[model samples]
Target: MSRVAVLMGGRSLERQVSLKSGARAEDALERLGHEVLPIDAGPDLVERLSTLAPDVAFIALHGRDGEDGTVQELLDVLGIPYTGSRVSACISCADKVLAKHVLRDRGIPTPDWHAFSETAFRELGAAQALPAIEERLAFPLVVKPAGQGSALGIKFARTAADVPMALVSAFSYDRKVLLERYVPGRDLAVSVLEDADGEPRALPIVEAVPNEEDFYDFEARYEIGRTRFVCPAELDDELTGRASELAVAAYRALGCEGFARIDLMLHADGGELDVLEANVVPGLTETSLLPQAAEAAGISFDALIARVLELALNRA
Candidate 1:
């Protein structure tokens, strides 16, 4: 058994969620016979890690400093092995605009998007740009911070009047904002784990259907019953396989390692499946997609944690 540090709760909007993830991961690791240390990553994370050195860091962080490669870089500098994507991949995947550019270049199907700053939108307003944007991407585009997760500062603009407010709100979370064609479809997510053999294994696909809301928002995602998840989602076998393949492809294309979750939009019209985003550090809570998928794959929570640690240790 290795000495593992479960790191979580950074100075990010997802701090509370991260703490929960860390707690779950910590418990799972302990049950698996690993000597584990749980640490709340705050502003002085570097100082804290310097003192409590561990063989590997099981990063349970989400958003901002935790998910954006900052913590990964710190671990790299400390010569400590951590699970998930490398520093560069973390930055590329965390930034939606950058990830889309890479995906588009690779001929991956994704919604057409445009990135703009708040000042540009404020000065130009909607009449000049909105008309053309509406024509190209159309109305009902998605507005979201270029680098964020858990649906923070995300808006669906269905009308011209909503564009300005959406831009303002999205920019508040991140200076760069993404405006993309909103694909009307069933929301689905797939988690992929890279085993010790360096092979990527896609887990069962999960279909997320928000009950009241049109899309999964912060409240809908965390609040029980707000969204219904169908694991091994009821899909045609071919569709399910395709989604799983696309998920693994996306994970590799973004340079993610160990494990990652890819979010997708399967259009209702069956036109095409669009990739939304990839989460290198997916939630580890009992109800999170990654854990649920693992459970479906015959891996218990403790076994999953042990596998992740084994992968991290090998990297060390």
Candidate 2:
């Protein structure tokens, strides 16, 4: 057993979710006979890590500094091995616009999007900008912050009148906002992990069904029973194989390390799949998709935690 620090509850919009994830992880690690220290990440994160030096850090934090590579950079300087991707990979996957570019460059299929800064939106005026966006992407577009997770600051605009409010809401969370053509389809998530052989492999595909919400928003994601996850998704062999392949490709393209959860949209016609986003540090709460995928693959929660810790130690 090794000393493991589970870092969570950072100063981010997903702080509450992070706390839940960290608590679950801490319990799993302890059950696996490891010395677990739960730390609520904050401005004094560096100091806290120094005070409780552990063999490895289980990063359960999400959004902002936790997911944007800020905390990873500090951990690197402190010479502490942590779970999930490295600094560069985390940085690339943290921003939606950047991740889309990487996926497209890698020949991965991702939805076409337009990104603009809040200042540009304000200076250009909605009348001047709205027409161009409508012409390019059409109606039923998804407006969201380029650098947030858990579907925070996300809005779906079905018409021109909804664009202004959507932009305002999204820009409130981030300076850069992305507008993408919303594709109607099934929501699927693929969790990829580096096996004992150090090879990145895709786990079972999880289909997320929102009970009442139109989209899998923050509520559907964290609220228990709000979303139903069908593991190995109800897709046929061909589609499942294709999704799994795309997921692994996306993971490698982003240079992801330990693990990641890739979200995709399976079109209604079941002919096309568009990569939505790559989550470097996916949520580990009871309602999270990654853990559900692992459980479906016959890996218990305790074993999964131990495996993630093993991956971190091996990389170190």
Candidate 3:
């Protein structure tokens, strides 16, 4: 087999989660008979990789330095093949505002939202900006950091009074914040993967049911048994087909390669679908939706990891 490096534990808020993902990936790669080297990604990642010189890199990094295309670009410069999207796709998908713009431009149906930078908010002052934000996206809005993942720095505001605090929390994580019209509905996730022939295909749809929280926050996502996932989600054939198609469309629109997970909300009416965001490097932990969907498609964890590595090796 190939010499594979499983990169994990970057200097991001999601470092612990990434470490778990990396450990799981490393175990799977080893099970598939690959020579695996697990690397705890840090400031000296480049130096460590130069020394290990693995044939391929399995990126299990989440958030900031890992998922925001920084590590991807570094891998590109080192001429190392890594699983998941390239730098450009990673950069675009990492930023919620940019991803939404791309989706809308591609005729994809994403939720209507407004984005503002910390500088603009400070200059305009909360008094001026808050009213403008409310006017743009009414109450029952989702406020989040534009560049974070796993639902970090996310808050739900049901009234004008809640907006300021949400903005503060969001700005703490990113200078840019997005306020999206909250769509009340079923939380669904679709995984898209490129086959051996390089054709992108959508896997089974997954419905996320948060056990305690109203939304799937970081805790609900990583905490064991905190969320119940219904794979091949209880959606009717038509809804499932549409969601799968939309997932592929979003994946292609973002120019993603290897695999990505598209998050969508099926309105409570069970008709409309609103694309939320695209995750270039989806979580690989035991609780991740991708693996659950893969299992439903009859692909074991080892096989799925092997296929991802194959895609990385064949990537142009």
Model 1: pairs clashing at backbone N, Cα or C within 3 Å: none
**Candidate 2 structure quality by residue, lDDT tens digits, 198-286:** 79889999998778754625445546677788887998899999999999999999999888999999988747999999999898988
lDDT of 1 by residue, 1-316 (tens): 8888889998889998899999999988888888898888876777878888888899999998778999999999999899888898899899999999988888888899888876776776633776788778987788899996798888888787888888888888998898899888888999999876768899999988777864624445547888888898989988988999889888888888889999999989954798999998999987889999988889888877877777877777
lDDT of model 2 at residue 72?
A: 91
Worst ten-residue run, lDDT, model 1? Answer: 213-222
CA lDDT for candidate 2: 0.88
Candidate 2 local Cα displacement, residue 301, angstroms: 0.9
Ranking by lDDT: 3, 2, 1
Report the number of clashing residue pairs per model. Answer: 0, 0, 0
Off by over 4 Å in 3: 124-127, 212-226
Q: What lDDT does candidate 1 reach at residue 148?
A: 67
Scored by Cα lDDT, where does model 3 land?
0.88
Each prediction's TM-score versus the true structure: 0.95, 0.94, 0.95
Q: What lDDT does each candidate get? A: 0.86, 0.88, 0.88
